[model samples]
Target: MYEKVINASYDPIFIADKDGYGIKMNEAYTRVTGITEDQLIGRHLKDVVKDGIISESVSLKVLKEKKQVTIIQHVNGKELLVTGNPIFDDKGNVSHIVTNLRNISALKSLEAELSRTKELANKYLQEIKIYQKKEDMISHEGVIANSRQMLNVINLVQKITPFNSTVLLLGESGVGKEVIANLIQKWSTRSNKPFIKVNCAAIPKELIESELFGYEKGAFTGADSRGRPGLFEQAHTGTIFLDEIGEMPLQLQGKLLRVLQEFEVTRIGGRRTIKIDVRVISATNKDLESLVKRGEFREDLYYRLNIIPIKIPPLRKRQEDIPLLANYFLDQANQKYHLNKQLTDDALLAMKAYAWPGNVREMQNLIERLVITTEADDITASHLPFSNQTAFVPQPIQKKMKEVLQDIEREMILKAISEYKTTRKAAEVLGISQSALVKKMQRLGI
Candidate 1:
């Protein structure tokens, strides 16, 4: 029965020695890894699977813990959930790692099929407008913004909501990227269509293809019984939000780039390519420029999706919007808690001064806490929570010769002053004779 379970499992199973040598592999492993049982046996496990790109600490832990660990692996163009477990000897020490690799590329195919069903359901729904608006979460009823930057974002979304163009939201994590994405879809022409979301970072690399463009049954072993539709097919005439687009593996980047260019997709092990009319919108908080320069992300793909770039300025950059967002939350709390929620001027000021590394999302969580904890409607500065009082950081500007010289001078003076207690100490800190430092300082007009 145990052997039957192992053989019947859909996921690939591998047993490797402590040093990373494969001792045994299941049939599923052969189908995905392309390494036959005989060939895999006694081979270096990591060598056979280069896509894993594991660190030394991982191997050590697997051996030491005598426990199990799961890793999301992207090899070639396939995605797999590889779970490794330590095998113990008579002394209870870990001897080998019995790992299971489940190829979920096919699962994504299933998701695509499921998505089509969702679209068909949409077509038959009553009050299509109301249902679509709710489905896409279009209303800004719950969102709150006080700062000019947040206001600008609200304004931009309001502007684009009436249009049918592809939208790209750029910002850091915990910045309500999804909130903005939902708002865009809720107000777009395809609101009646499925607002399918695909997180590029969450999906396994190998499975990204199937997740994006599904696969046919028997296209590969462990696939669903019925060949499934891809996300493109599921989102036909609808909208698909590709979040964390930067984490997509390079090989799949080509596939995604192709879909964006041709507006079509083909399934794995399928004969014909399927044409799709879905509007493609993507969001990312990554340094895509650096990725492109390093040959990590495709440049062509970047230009294609960046058509309607909506820069969701980080909360730190747009500090002015915090109060509005806070009030929106307070109104929400009033409705929920049946209490008149309010904040004092000092409290509001304190919130405005803190550095929001997590952005709007972080702010939201903090406000919720304040709403639940505070007693007074008019919350005071003492009621507010913050580690320090600092305004937003200034964005970097690429200036020409004059600004560069001034920046250089400012940095030197600041560093010198900081290192020393006074101007004399600062002069000494520069390491030049005091007279030379004074002369240079005068010349630079510092």
Candidate 2:
């Protein structure tokens, strides 16, 4: 009956003799630890896992001191809560020591959720304190925008900053998603903790898992030099911004979902599970709902992340803000290049009239180009590149219109690559920004 109960219990149940040898362990324990019964049967508890404290010392302490020792551990990507105590024999001596392990993956996830909640609460309290004392909360420059669309986005951000809910920022290329995430962190209670960003699309398919969640040394070929920390682990007490999360390979999606659910990360090839207090704010340009229905993305993970969704309208959608955005960028250009600047009505109109595929970021570069390439503060239509006389003509009237679009896109990408030496650069060339580029890549499934 006792053996049956141990076997039936969902908690990893095991019996270790006074000598610290495992006398028995149920299937749950084996599954959670990934240490088979065959290997651990006659072995000492220390051999179970390197970081596990179930060594002879812990066993001895429990046997001699007659007290319970509870420890949290990581095993096979799961968090485990283990309680060890001495089991006395008929002679009233410690003959066997029993260890009750509860797979705390669920508990750890809850704790992580609670930690994020508490962090937001603390951030609000701190913000209130700062407001009460200083009378203002300064917005960081790289992170602020007065573009009417961006203004609305910022207002929403302020409203949501006090909560730990997962935020998914969506938009066309060039809008600064990372900047928004940084703003979120700046207002978060976990501001003092690390803020790690992982570009799911940036990492090679083979390395994405190890990069985001880390791996045990020798877990796979080309592992990190010292088993480096993963994005989730590095974020520890702070936030992890998962950029282009839609590009994350299907295989790793389940693992990421587990991390979100369990609030603990198990390193590859390593037995210890580490608890984390990370607020996950994921951004992607991909339509996850479509992916879910198509069976390409996990429904559970989507539901978890879709807790809060904020869409960043593409630059073209918010054309009213172009004038302000251009002027602000011109100011930045002047400060950086020491060039006095002004945009002529025709020049500004041309820019305003141009369908800004790249958004605010594209306009910024256009201003900078007008600043450096032109010789005057007053940049006219002639200074603008897209305002070329031929640009206004519809491509369908030309031969191979479809081909022309591809060629245009290809040329722009290549030019950006040549200029920026990266996809991030190419995205900039197309008038969208980096995170926006990430979205395009996800959309293109690139």
Candidate 3:
């Protein structure tokens, strides 16, 4: 019955005598080792090892050690997990050694595949996180500004909100001219009214008039049979933001000037004149003065648009704001990508020192790129693409040591006040009396 049970088992099993000689083996053992049972039974394990039928004998180790042993064994060109357990007699002597063998090639292959799958899953998860962060940052609302120049611009915007004066925003491309336009619309009394935006540069010269003024039916070939209201008429009783106004065609400029002066529009192939009450907010990156001088732009239109000119300073002129902007952008990126990343002191210094010709938009894009590509939680100078680029290095300004010390002291006092909130607490933090701290703050204009 024992022999029948052993023979019926799926795992390979072999039993050895006290002297390490094979006494009996199951049919599975013979099948696994590719050896006949007649040849295996009653044969010494050392003899099987010497004959190269099995690589090593765990049974022999168990017999010598008088304990259980497990090892990897190579037999008949297959890998196996072989375990040998000793059976003890009354005298604590190893009476027999029973060994079991299990094939391990399939398990090893499965382990490797699982490892590869985990690596791929981790890679894809990181990519998805970055994409999510980008969406979140891009969807953030409001203008990000803290510089004095920008503050003045904001003040000017606020001052003009009560009236319907035509505002002309002037700045280099990507300096957020559109953002100012939107702010104007939001602050105006007509905030609930529709604020239409039109890019003069993007529209064709032939379609400019029709796009700006409502066209009558059959006004021209391929005109919509039902007729169409132009952007100006559509923005009636609201605001119309015309971006890149310098790109307006010479002839269209005359018509636009007329509409601005008369507050009326004449549709193509139509006799009826339409009166409209729409606020015009024009923006341009080009110099309208240059265009006027070159006869490319109407001088009358330039004067009308320049009534309330607001020039947005480039990012380089507002270097003190870089730290604030950088941290803001970093926070946005972190919220977007579901990650916590910070800029190193050196990284911030490097950013502030560099000239941003592409302006605020460039800084925003760079911050996003660094957040995504950098592996470290803290973004160091090495992670910046422009860190090694040849850039403008400012000449050091000569200053007295006492003056520099005063600057450092003022900065420390401001920092302590911000952190502690109360003058007494700030004084304790700075190791000074509250009265003295107040005196210094007054002198430093803190």
Candidate 4:
């Protein structure tokens, strides 16, 4: 029954005589250590350790000390916590030593994972503090402007904020035109008043007229029961930001032109004209002059909105601000997603080299995605979705044909790996075996 209990125990059990010769071992001992009863039962503990079968013998230690002994042991590449207890005979002499072996590999693995998680949490906290300090210094009302062009734009905004002139913000779609509009409103006398923003492109042509100019209660089907005021009425004592003015339909352009000229708007089905005391701010990425020449836009209305045009340069043109903006966006993403991600120097270099067609908006989205998807804390050049190798790293003036070929090969492999996001898929795309691709990557230092 004692043998049955010992064999039934989940933990491995080993028993040896007081002389340190193994006397008995359970089935669990054989399963855990991969050592059969024949191999260890007749063998001495000292011999087992000498033969490199186990790291140490807790039973031997217990025998020497005449007391219980606990130790960490390694057997068959597994970590174990082993405890040995000595049994004394009636004569007060040690008679037997019994040991219990508990595998601690899973616990060790869990401990390592927890340690990594803690380290990442601490890193994220530190990153947040650093960025918060920098944000306080460099940001102006949530706008990051370090480049000369952007600084000049901000200066221009400050100059024009006191005036009620119609300001036209011209830039690429993601160039923060709306931010400039917000700045104007924030610094203007109408800061306390309502600021109505209408995206002309987002609204449908059929409803835009009613939406912008307001309509009577029964103006059309699906109309609001109570008479609703338009965006211009909503901004009677404030400012109105019209985004994507270029996409405003031509038919509605005449009414918009009249509103700009008279500061009065007649509702879609209302006879009375309401005068609005509001400042107008319009922004567009399209070339209004070209649109005017094409008759797609009204030339007269164009001049009205262009009274104080502020052209925001694209992101590629203002490369100096990339680092600041990148860090700012990274900080935001970390805060939002609870991630600890940082960009490497090479990653920053790659960003500066690439032509940001989508401008600041792309960088913001990409940073958020990296913060969420990246496994490592440091986001390196390899982690970037797009890499411009020739622009990022200056090539040597003179190179051998073999070196040139190697450069092309390296570029191709890097591009494939970055695009596919895995060695096996990249290898398949490159028409090479996974092992060959790995070997090539190693040689190229990829």
Candidate 5:
């Protein structure tokens, strides 16, 4: 029964006496090593090694060392992992040594396959990074960042999108801070997750808390009977954009700070907390540092949200991008309204000269308005509405010098008329006759 049990094992087994003479062998030994029973049953292990049946003898090492031994033995062009464990008699003398052998070629093949798989995985990761970089360079969602400042901003957005850190966007109103937030979400790993946008300034102070952290059923008057999840809850496992974050209430800012610290929120009328995984992005035109100094904003929350700050440059500073933006908006408006309105060189030059106080938003709206309202195919400098004389100052050495001068004259006459109520008073201020003023106004389509 013991011999049958030992023969049942898949691995080859050999039993040797104390002096290292082989005493018995399992059927697997003959089947795996292709050695006949007579070759090893009565032979000493050292003689087996000398016969070249095996390159080494683990049983002989076990007898010499008086302990277990292991080695790789080459037999019939195959590698065997052989381990010999000694059995001691009552007198602590070696009674026998039992050796077990297993083939290791398949394990080596599996290790090679795993190494190739790791290499392929790394190659795919590098390729994905290159593809993502190219995608970031192409504009999305009306974002045309041609200036060096805006390009740097885009690059920073790309670098930080992989992380879950909070981002604070600082810029003047209409500088497209919201657009940058959208791009951040679009490029992130959570792109398929929910995206919730809330304007802190738009909501009333009394309801802002409930609008952010949710409430239980019947928590307040006019509350829904079944209760509702707030914007933060709805944005779980995704991103939340807090627009105009500076306008958030002071009392509620403490709760927001808690949420940021704990990654959990308690409803207005419930004690239970709901855990969330959300990436926060905030935007504010107001100066948060000034607000903090005045004690109007929470200092801790400000620092928490400002982990990564991106300040978008206003339109006036990046005037070089004005022409590109103007043409882009023009094309967009034309496509939407199915109109063929085109801006002439004088019109573009005048636009670039004027300071766009309202930034990209104002430019986009104005272009759409021009496309809809202008009747002629070509919109010239005379058709522009920048009526301030200082803003329409003539530039030196221009292709359309005559048109530029005419625009300046029109701006001056309009300013004078706006300051002095009557046309007669405006003409006197301009040192021109009323008839000449009116004729020039008509000619310039003022």
Candidate 6:
């Protein structure tokens, strides 16, 4: 029964006597080695290796060591795992050695295939992450402009997208200059490359140089230990948006001009200059021409940047686009806050009437505020947040043209103040003398 069970086993099995001669072998052993049972049963283990019938025998090693052994054996161009164990008699002497062999070629192949599959899965996951990041960066559904002025700006953006030229986006604060810059990058030929944004006004003046040009190790105090690449290096073969370019210090303007002219940057502490291929897009609410006249900005840099100037019209100038922009913002607010809200005709009229001092950004904020604060599902003129009643909806008895013009003038002066740092700057932006602006501010109760 034991012999029959051994012969029926799937794994190759061999029994060798203490003298190292094969005394018994299963049919599986003959099938694996291509040696018949008659030829294998009485063959010495060392004689099989000498005759090249089998590779190194584990049974011979077990007999010599008087212990169990495991070895890899190559036979007939196939890999096999061979394990051998010595059986002892009553006097503690070796009686025979039992050996088992298993073909591991298919198992090894399966293992290699599994490793390759895991690597491919990891690569796909990384690609998904990259695509998700790009989606987040480029998605801007709120930038809707139907006004002729805005359409012209969009047209100019489309025309210049195919070429690599410096673009200077001039607009009032909250007029969506950043949104336009992102659109240019998304539509450009280098859309697949990186789009790096740097707010010159937001970054500290002391650190702006290193942040734009990168730094080697120990470049300055509190610097990264391993060194770091700056925005210019990161934007190689892509686009770098310099938001609020008017705020960059005069000292760093020369360095920036050099980069724009030579297409190269030198690290803050390193001596070597690295070449880069990048498109520059700069935006600002301030008047760069006035800045140059005041010696606050570089004239050479201004000409280089103004190669492709795109002026995004303020909300007041594009009142025709208010309904579309308002509805879009309203929908966004409802979706963001998980509410179902609609704008009444009165509410839409009120939004169109009001001079959006904060422009699109202010409109979006007002919509979100109304969506959250209003008790009813329908937003009416009463839900608007304006101090002046006439600002929300036009009255049946219209004011004189002079009075209407004064109201528009008041709103512009206030907006200019909110957009600029000082009264002089605000006056320059409003195209009025400083004394006249101050007098107007006092009369309007601003």
Question: Model 4 over residues 175-256: C-alpha lDDT tens digits?
Answer: 9999889989999999999999999999999989988999988888899978789999999989999999999999999999
C-alpha lDDT of candidate 3 relative to the true structure: 0.84
Predicted structure 5: lDDT: 0.86
By TM-score, the better pick of 3 and 5 is 5
When summed lDDT is taken over every stretch of 10 residues in candidate 6, the lowest stretch is 390-399
| Model 3: worst 10 consecutive residues (lDDT sum) | 390-399
Q: Which pairs of residues have clashing backbones in candidate 5? A: none
What is the per-residue lDDT of model 3 for residues 1-446, given as tens digits with 9 covering 90 to 100? Answer: 98899889998899999998888888888777776866667788899889887899999999888888999999877888999999999999999999998878767888889999999999999999999666433332367667678878878988999999999999987788999999899989989998999999999888888999979999898999988889999999999999999999998888899899999988888888899999999999898898999999999999999999999987766766678788888988999999999999778867765666678889899999889999989998778776664333322343356645554565466556656889999999999999999999887555
Which has the higher TM-score value, candidate number 1 or candidate number 4? 4
Maximum-lDDT candidate? 4
Which residue pairs in candidate 6 have backbone atoms (N, alpha carbon, C) closer than 3 angstroms, thus clashing?
A: none
Which candidate do you rate higher for lDDT, 2 or 6? 6
TM-scores, all models, native as reference: 0.54, 0.56, 0.56, 0.58, 0.58, 0.58
Report lDDT (CA) for all predictions: 0.72, 0.74, 0.84, 0.88, 0.86, 0.85
* Displacement of the residue 100 alpha carbon in candidate 1, Å: 97
lDDT string, candidate 2, 29-103, tens digits: 777778677766777766755545333234545766776887776666776777888877798878887877777
Better of 1 and 3 by TM-score: 3
Q: Report the alpha-carbon TM-score of model 3 versus the true structure.
A: 0.56
User: Model 5: residues >4 Å from true position, as ranges?
Assistant: 1-138, 387-446
| Clash pairs (backbone) in predicted model 3 | 133-336, 133-337
Model 6, position 444, has a per-residue lDDT of: 57
